[model samples]
Each structure stands twice: as C-alpha cells, then as structure tokens.
Target chain A: MAGVRAAVVGTGLIGGSLLLRLRDAGLDVTGWDPDPVARGHVRRWGVACPDAVEAAVTGRDAVFLCGPLPTLSGMLARVAAATPEHCVLTDVGSTKAEVAATATASGLGHRFVPGHPMAGADRAGPAAADPGLLVGAAWVLCPGPNGLASFRRLAALLIEVFEARVVPMSAPEHDAAAALSSHVPHLLAGALAGAVQRSTLRDAVLSLAAGSFTDGTRVAGGPPQRTANMLLGNRDRVLSGLASVRAMLDELADALRAADAGTLTDRLAEGRAARATLGERRFDTHQREFPAPADHAGELDYLRALGAAGGHLTGCRTAGGAVTYTGQLPHTPDPA
Target chain B: MAGVRAAVVGTGLIGGSLLLRLRDAGLDVTGWDPDPVARGHVRRWGVACPDAVEAAVTGRDAVFLCGPLPTLSGMLARVAAATPEHCVLTDVGSTKAEVAATATASGLGHRFVPGHPMAGADRAGPAAADPGLLVGAAWVLCPGPNGLASFRRLAALLIEVFEARVVPMSAPEHDAAAALSSHVPHLLAGALAGAVQRSTLRDAVLSLAAGSFTDGTRVAGGPPQRTANMLLGNRDRVLSGLASVRAMLDELADALRAADAGTLTDRLAEGRAARATLGERRFDTHQREFPAPADHAGELDYLRALGAAGGHLTGCRTAGGAVTYTGQLPHTPDPA
Candidate 1:
C-alpha cells in the first residue's frame, strides 16, 4: 500500500481534486488532461503531469478515468490497453451503466470498476479543484463478476486514503438510484428556473425568491453541458424518475386545485417524514465483516445486496486464501 | 420616527425577530403570544410581554399580526378592534389575497396592509428568532385603496429600521408571483424528498444524497403543517404553477426518452440562463421619485406597477402638501 502508484486522466475539477487527494495521501500519483490549461495547472501544483493519458497511467496500480460521459468509453479503452494487467480501473462519471457495458464489451470488465463520487462544486475546471472535495463523500463503485479483487483495491484507497465511503452496487442499480438522487433533481432545478424566467412576473418572482427558491434551483446553475450529458447518458432511468416525479406533482396540484386540505397536508407530511430520513450530512459508522464469496457471481450479488441495504465497504483482507470483506453500516436499521 | 410605538402579536420566529428589531431601532415595542412559553421568552429579552393581544396593541402606531394562517384572520380582527385609529396593521402571513379579502370584509382594509417577509429559519417559535432575519430580506406589502399613507409609514419602518426591501404589489399579484417563487418551490422540494424516500434504493439514494439532493429538498424539512397551510392558502396559483412545472418536467422526460439531445440541452440551457437571472442576493439600489398619486386607485396602481417591475419603495416626503414617493430600483433593467 505504501508503494501504490495511481494516475488520474482528465484533470478537471473532479479529477484534479482526486489527483491532489491521492498525492496528499502519499501515493505516487501522475496526472494528465487533454486540456493544456488543466495540465499546466497540475504541473504548477507540483504534481507530475504527463503529456499523454497513456504515459500517466503506465505502471500504475490504479487508474481513474475522470472524463465527461461522452469521452469515458474511449478513455477507459485507451487506459485499459496501456495499464498493466494488475491495474485496477475506475471512472468518476456520474452515470455508470454505459461505461460498465463498454468495459465488459471490450473484455476489460474483470479489472474495471465503474465509480461515481457524489461530490461537486458550482464551479468547474482544475483551477477550482480542492483535495477536500472527496473527503467524507459517498463514492459508488459498481463491481462486475471478475472485478471483486479490483473493487477491493480501489475501495480501500477511497476509504482509507481519500476518506470516502465506498458503496458497492451493480451498474444498473447505480444508474437507477442516481436518476432519483441526482439527475432528476438537476432537471427539476432547471425546469423551476426556466418556469420562473418565462413568467410575466419574472422580475418580481426573482426579487421575492427566498431560501426555498434558491436551494431548489441551485443545481440549475451548474455547467449546462455536463448536466445534459448526465441526464442523456442515463436516459432511461432519468425518464422513469422524471415521470414518477411529474405524477407526484400532478397529484399534489389536483389536491391543491380541489382545496383538499386533508390530502394536501398528508402529502406534505409524507414528504417531511421522508426528508427526515436523510438524517444528517454524515453518519456514524458501525462496522461488519462478511466472508468473501467463492465465485464471481456470488461476489457481485453479495456486494450489491450490501450496498442496496446502505452498507459501504471499508476494506478487505485475505487470510490463508480466504478473503473477508469489512464494511460499515449505519446504526439506524431503517432510515424511515 | 423616534418614539413610534409598535406591537407584534404572536411572537413566533418572524414576529419575535421584528419585535427585537423594532426595539433596537429605539421604538416603544410590545409583544404578545398566546403561548405562555413564547410570552415568557419575549419578557426574558427585556421587552413588554402582554397577556392579551388587545393590551399589547393598545395605542400602537403600527401593529403586526404574526400568527399561523388559520389564526391570522382572528388575530387581525382582534388587533383591528383594539388598536388606535392611526395604527397601521400588517400580518406576516405567506398568502396575502385571502387575508386582504378578510380585512376588506371586516371594513379594516384601509388600515390593514397584508405583508409577507421573505425570511425564515428551519426552527420556529420565539426562542429561535434572530433580529438579523429581517436584514436585507424582501418584505412584500400589498397595499389597497385608502392605505397609501399607511403603506408609506410601514414601508419606512421596514426600509430604514429593519433594512428590509419593501416590495409593493396587489394581493393577487403577490400571491401569483409567490407561487412561482416560493410556494411551488416548497411543493417541489417535498415531492422530491418523498419520491426518494419511496424509492426501492431508498438507503442507497440517501447515502448518495449530495448538494443537489440536499438543496433540492431543504424546504421539505420545514414544519409540515406550516408548509401545508401556505400551499393551501395559495392553492389556485400553486395549482397553476405546479401544472406548468409538471408540463416542463414531462417535456424534459420525453426528450430524454427519445434521446433528443438537442431538445434536452436546449431545455437545460434555458434553465441555467433563467437561474442566472436571479443574480446576486443583494442588488445595488437606484432611487427614483414619483409624485404621489392623487387618488387611492392611482396610488395602488403605481405601487403595484413599481413592484411588478422589481422596484421597492424606500420612503416618501411631503412639502407644501405635495407628496412624493421615493423608491429603489435595481440598476440592471432586465435580470435576464
């Protein structure tokens, strides 16, 4: 672990932040960015900045592809080809299904773990990068059948070095959950912003906007192109989530129009109860250990189940060839 | 304005904060709450705490009713009966139209100004109040016929003492704009929070709840009963705004389902553009003076027009019986 070498390709906000975190953790980290400006910023930060993604990832124990959704597949393929056989691969893309599929189709699934770090800033680019971005963030890692060992390696770095909670789930599960938690929120924010802008009382609406309006539309202020890519990349799940949200809204509207106070109050109370289950920004961890599965499918199923139940892998160890995975679960059994 | 007497009825968060601000401004202030705990808290702050609303508002130059929506009408009626003739009565209810109607029905419309301060906290009650809550917050005042002088007096207190921007509009106009800016946002937040809670991946979703999820659902964390009351009070406008937002969301879903990147990107960009129009929290003021209207209708129309244009009344002056109203307008003509 002390001699572990890592590389981060595409040194924008997320990647640059990861690169800095890894370097601060005393890992030998090399970084690369297609944008010369990003690469120059990394070099100025006193980190190794290789001119090529291939050069940066060569001989690294772990390689992270931190490109936009549209570029992830190509970047993953190139990184997969250049890195050593023992290298564990992951990406910081918001959506995971497509990337995981691309890796599996290319026969790189065994070593590739599609990941998404649930953290960001309003600003983008390397200049806005800070190592603190990953601290205590939930980093979801979708591990395939043959990628159990790779998941363990990558998750250990995320947990121990970056102080990130490593959530293990399948790519499809990850995508569906993300649609509800992230993508749809972005779309909703945008829609709210757009609706207010188009209102005849647009100026007045903006003037009267309070905490609710500000918080509800804050995500719409993010880079539009990136948000679009995320919603589009996870199109099916986002569509389903959007439809569900729309129906919920329509129901509330009907209740309001009908002056059904009982129904409206119940709906709002349900929401308040649900929001209370979010608990807090950070949670107290209760660790648990499980014997690793005997095969690939067994490993995948076990990890997915644990994550579905809100458990996160901390690390794993092998004693006499019998692997054991250690994870942390919240003390509260049901958030509800 | 020195020695001006002010009374705040139902000293909860908004009322308590106002009572503190009024006292700090060197006004003779009295506060009362039906709840003994709240009245006790106000007394602890070295302010007069009256047992009855009548006694609290007696001889007051300005009286503020800061109770829940259901209690507002009764409180307003009681205060109207108890206060002196020169007293300018106002309420901090979220909805203006209904209360304004109630005041008109009771023949108290001339002295009653329906006002809503666009500031709040997660916690409620007098103990949670902070004098700074009203600082630089938008305080919407729906002024009607015969209330021009009353509006000017109350607005001067808000502008000069509390540092609140006084937005003048009609009751219906205020409600409609608020639906888009505040009420609808609250509904949307609750809906989002509820949807995630009911998701199959509820735990995973909560674990991955980042800034967007947190911000999008923050308002859902407020008191459910109060939020429900606000939404129900402004039911018609909220219905309209919710319908419009539903259509926008459904359209985005259709675009995502069809993989219509062009339409999706365009929609997101529009939202980003719209959100950008929110601009800075505080805007630079450009003061303008207008000759006071000769009639009640003229005054109401002028004030509503100014508020609709995102301008706020600052103060007014009279010389040789010629009244002139001075207001502040943002330097930027169009936020968009």
Candidate 2:
C-alpha cells in the first residue's frame, strides 16, 4: 500500500477530499486539475502536481477520474488507450450505466471500478476538500466481470484508506438506489424552493420558515449545473422516484379534498412510521422526552443541561403551565 | 398581563406550552383536557385543572382554545355562549380562515384572535410541551376588526411572555402563508418519506440516505392525525401550494426528458438563489475553509486544529502522498 501510486483528476470537493485521504494514507499520489489555480493549490500541499492527465496516469497503480461525467468518460478512454496494464482506473461519479458502458467499450471494463462516495457539500473545488468527508459514508462500487479482481483490490484500498463502507452491486442496482437516495431528493428540494419563490408572500413566508423548511430545502442550495446533471444523468430512476412521490401526494390531496379524515390519518400515520425508521440515523442519535421547566429562563437552563448531557432539546410543549421537552440523548436508547 | 386569568381548553403541545408560558409570566391559568391523564399532569404542575371546558372558560379574562380543528370550533361555540363579555378568546390552529369564520358565526369574532405558531415537534401530547417552544419563533395573529384592540394586547403579551414574534395579518393571508411555509412542507415531507418506503431498494437506499434526505423528511415524523388535520383543514391553500410544486416538478421533468441542461440549470440556479436567501435564518452561522494535513493521525489533529480555530474540516485531498484539508471558519463567509 505504501508503494501504491495513485492519481486524482479534478481537484474539486470530492476529488480534493479523495486526494487528501490518499495522501494521508501514505500513497504515492499525483493530482491533475484543468484549473491551474486548483493544480497550484494541490502542488503547494505537496502532491505531485502533474502538468497533464497522461503524466498522472502513466505507470500509476490507480488513476481516479474525479471530474464531471463527460470529463471522466474522456479520461477513461485516454487511460484505456495508453495507461499500463497494471494501472487500475476508477471514478467517483453519480451515474454508473453510462460510465460502465464507456469502460466496456474501451475494453477495460474489468480494470475500471465504477464507484460513488455517498458524501458531498454545497461548495466545490480542491479548497473545499476534507479527508474525513467520506469516513463513515457509503462507497458504492459497480463492478463488471472483466475487472472483478481489480475492483476487489480497489475496494480493499478504499475501506482501508477512506474508512468507508464498500457496498458492491451492479450498475443498474446502484443507479436505481441512487435515484431514491439522491437524485429524486435533489429534484424535490428544487421544486419546494421554487414553490416558495413563487408564493405571493414569498419574502414574508420565507422569513417565517423554520428548521423544517430549511432542512427540507438544504440540497437545493447546491450548484445548478451539478444538480441538473445528476438528475438528468439518472433520468429513468429519477422519473420513477418522482412518479412515486406524485402518487403519494395525489393520495394525500384526494383525502384532503374529500375531507376524509380517516383516510388522511391512515396515510399520514404510514408516512410517520416510515420517517421514524429513517430518523434513527439522524444527526442526533437517540431521542428522549424530559420535563421542561415552566419559565423562559428555566427553559434555557434545561437546554443547557441537555447539551451538557451530550444532547440537545429538539421539541417542547406546555400544559397548565407545566412544560415538557423532547431531546436526543446521545448513546442512549429510549426506554419506550 | 400579570392580572390576566387565562383558561386553555385542550392540554396538548401548543395549548400546554402556552399554558406553561402564561403561568410563568404570572398569569392565573386554568387548563382542561378531555383526556383525564393530560389534565392530571397539568394539575400536578400547579395549573388549576378544571374538569369541564365550560368550567375552564367561565369568568376567565382570556380563553385560549388549544385543540384540533373540530375541538377548537366546538370550544368557540361553548365559549361564545358561556364566557364573560370581557373574556378575549384566541385559538392556536393551523388554518385561520375556518376558525375565524366559526368564531364570527358564533358571534365572538371580535373576541377571538386566530393565531398560528410556526413551531412544532414530531411528538405530541401535553407531556411534550415546552415553555420555550415558541421562543424566537413567528406567531401569526389574524385579528378581525372587532378584536383589533384585543389582538394588539394579545400580540404584546405573546411577545413579552413567550418571546415570540407577533405577525399581525388577516386570516386569509395567514392561511396562504402557512400553506407555503408550514402546511405544504409537512405534506411534502410525508410524500418524500412515502416514496422512500415504496422504493424497490427501500431499506438499502434508506440506509445510504444522508443529511439531505433525513432533514428533508423531518416533519413527516409527527403524529399522523395531527398532520392530517392541519393539511385537510387548510385544504384550499394546501391545494394551491401542491399545484405550484407539481408545476415546478413538471417543468423539471420536461427539461430532464429533453436533456435540456440549460433549462434545468436555470431552474436549479433559481432554487439555489432562493435557498441562499432563506439560509440566513439558519442556526448554523459560520462557514470557512481551512487547510488540512496529510497522514492518518495528523488528519485527526487537523480536525482538532480546525475545531480550535472555530471551524471544522469539511473537505480533503492528497497529491504525491501529501494531504490538504478544507474546513469552514467560524463567522467567516466562504470565499469562492
């Protein structure tokens, strides 16, 4: 592993983060970015700043194409034609089918490990990279029969270096799952934000928006082209996810229109249960209910106490001047 | 405000929280709940627990109807018939229009102040109440002409006691805004969660779901009946909001189908800008990028360094076996 020479193309958030992790893992790493500023920045960080993609790819143990989809496809072609037989190629991209097809066409499908790290940020560029970004995140690898051995090696390296969980699956499965987890969520965020922008009291309403609205639309803050590209690239799955969402909404809408409280409550309960299952993986780990004090100052003190207990107050209510609070208790499961 | 003797009918989250806040502010508060357990909890907390709604309402200077839509409507009728003329009534409900109409029909329009607090939790019940739940949150007050003076006094009291921002507006205006800011978002959360639950790789994909998905569906975790009541009660505005969201999705779908990156980019950018504007009110106030170092142990140290600098490592990359990190600096704006 110490002698493993790896190269990263595109020094943006994902690429930059990968490069940093690789360097920290004590790999012989080379970095190439189309942007000279990015290249210079990596150079100053002590990475072997390559002047050309070919220079970074030549004789490398692994070459990770970290650019946009088109850039990665082009680099795959270049590596397939010129890189040494031992230079296992890979990529960190959202979509897999197209990339897999390109790698297969290049006769390097077996050697090309198609991967996607389920981690990102609103910002981009090498300067936004973090070695810890992918830690504890899922790293999906779409492996073809041709490069099964290489994919295994790459997966092992990823686990050891990035401390990421390697989930191996087919390209189609990866795409389908991603549509639900990432692609559709991005579209939903945009649509919700768009509705807000179109509201009659847009500014006033937005001013009143709290944690729910903000959290619901957090992904919409990402770069326009990046979001659009991911959504379009995974079109089929995105459409499928959207259809499911639309159908659910229609059900809720119909229930509301009919004033059918029973049906509405049933559907809402189903959703609430589903959300609770997912809630376990939230930023806060454990949730518990406690007695909240019936006073503003006491409430503040209660919040501080929760924080000191490695938790934070998430909800509060009062009845007859007696207050209660809900908070996430770290490392502790709810007795109920 | 201290001399105010207020009665709360329905000792639930909103009602309970309000009762606690009012009592903490030195008001004489009485609470009544159909559920004996809830009434007992508040009674033990020192609130005068009345056994009957009429008993709680009679002779009180203010009567806050804190219940579901139907309960609130029913209480308004009873209050109109039994409460003293000087008793100013108010309600905490999601939909203002129907509540206002009901109050008007009951001949208590001037006395009833329709309010909607823009704060909530996934859990409900009197046990979930927090005195500080509404602190720093927006509380919309829809006052009829007859209750203008009373509304002003109530607004002042809410501001002082609960530390809530009182936004005075018409009932219709309040409903429309809530549709965009609260109601629609709640429905959207359910729809998204439902979609995830219905996906082919439901469990697997959800396991990979990150902050975006979790945050996006946070509100869907609330009790089903509560969410259904709110959405169904505000049918018209909810429908309008849903229509807006559907149209936006349609546009995005068309662009994605056509592979029209330009249109998709434009829409996404629009969303991004809108989210940026709303982001100012976010609890997280600082975002700065810092340099990360190379090496496993050093990587941890880098994170500590960033933390010490009031920042956290967000991104990292490596070149030539040397690592670099990116992190957000506290109170510093991100420089592109």
TM-scores, each model vs. reference: 0.93, 0.78
Cα-based lDDT at residue B50, candidate 2: 76
- Native-referenced TM-scores of chain A, all candidate models: 0.93, 0.81
Model 1: CA > 4 A from native = A280-302, A314-326, A333-336, B280-284, B290-302, B314-326, B333-336
lDDT of 2 at B8: 85
Lowest summed lDDT across 10 adjacent residues in model 2 chain A is found at A285-294
The C-alpha lDDT values of all candidates are 0.84, 0.75
lDDT of 2 at B49: 89
Q: Per-residue lDDT for A38-135 in model 1, tens only? A: 88999999998988888888999998888888998888889888999999999999999888988999999889999999999767899889999989
DockQ scores for all predicted structures: 0.74, 0.26
Candidate 1: chain B TM-score against the reference chain B: 0.93
Candidate 1: RMSD to truth: 2.9
Clashes of each: 0, 33
- Candidate 1 has what TM-score? 0.93
Residue B50's lDDT in candidate 1: 83
Find the candidate with the highest TM-score and give its number: 1
